[model samples]
Target: MATAIGMVELTSIARGIETCDYMVKAAQVDLLRSSTVCPGKYMIIVGGETGDVRAAMAEGIKRGGELVVDTLMLPNVHEQLIPAISMTNQVDVRGAVGVLEFYSIASAIIAADVAAKAANITLIEVRTGYAIGGKGFVTLTGDVGAVRAAVEAARKDAELLVETTVIPRPDKKLFDALL
Candidate 1:
């Protein structure tokens, strides 16, 4: 089966949870994540076959109504994306490091994908709307040139880029703290 990922971000936690329940019951999608984010927003992420994920997303959007903040359906997501977002991917932070912060989780995910495909960089982490007041951020590491290219690519079309920085040669302690 061709795997796909879908996400629904809602303004209200109660409505988001209710939509998530309807979404899952509407299709054979697997619920990957369902939780409240900072500032009292909620999100639901699901994964399954392409069609199933689409069906689930459709149900979520229909049920979300006025509470719908944002929605996404990636038919062909990067294989490493989930692990990176889940903070389970181990990446060696060598040479240089880049960070991209965004105002929305969907924008951050898009930036991460663009950055990963634009340069030979390893994703250190992809955090979304958990403890950062509903914002999102992604970290990457590679050679100086590669890191710069990745960060530049991510910044080009970000929804709201809070900040972006590329450290040419970060100290080990910084990597330890971040990674």
Candidate 2:
């Protein structure tokens, strides 16, 4: 149910937490996540109406100041994006599977949104830098052609890309570890 979402990555954990508090107080928004990632990076994600998210983002960036590393705001976010990030989207591992990995969380989230909008696909997961050494990755499944197209579209927008691949037919056992 997220219409607009904003994210801020900071170099300081304390600044990031303080920014999150002020951001929520600045606007009516949902605090999707606010925690330290790998390598001592801190992240904050908020979602709500466009205006509200915008205000919250402004406050967060201002508070983050020199500690800010990266930020992104999606005004018309894809419907599948939130579910994927929350690990709530359900779908079988059908057809081809595409994967996108990035060095930044914002790039991975952006790739997920772009992929969802570019083709008919089911998002498997939109994983952020939690315990993965400050890396982000996205997974989706669809027909081979659609998966390929979606991956290409997402790649063009991805920043700090680490790797990308598409499997025409992934062994089902591989999904066990991914899930």
Top TM-score hit? 2
Per-residue lDDT, model 2, residue 58, is 98
lDDT of 1 by residue, 119-144 (tens): 88888888889999999999889999
* Candidate 1 residue runs with Cα over 4 Å from true position: none
Whole-model lDDT per candidate: 0.88, 0.91
All models, RMSD in angstroms = 1.8, 1.8
Error of 2 at 63 (Å): 1.7
Q: TM-scores for all candidates?
A: 0.90, 0.92
Q: Tell me the lDDT of candidate 1.
A: 0.88
TM-score of 2: 0.92
lDDT over C-alpha atoms for residue 93 of model 2:
49
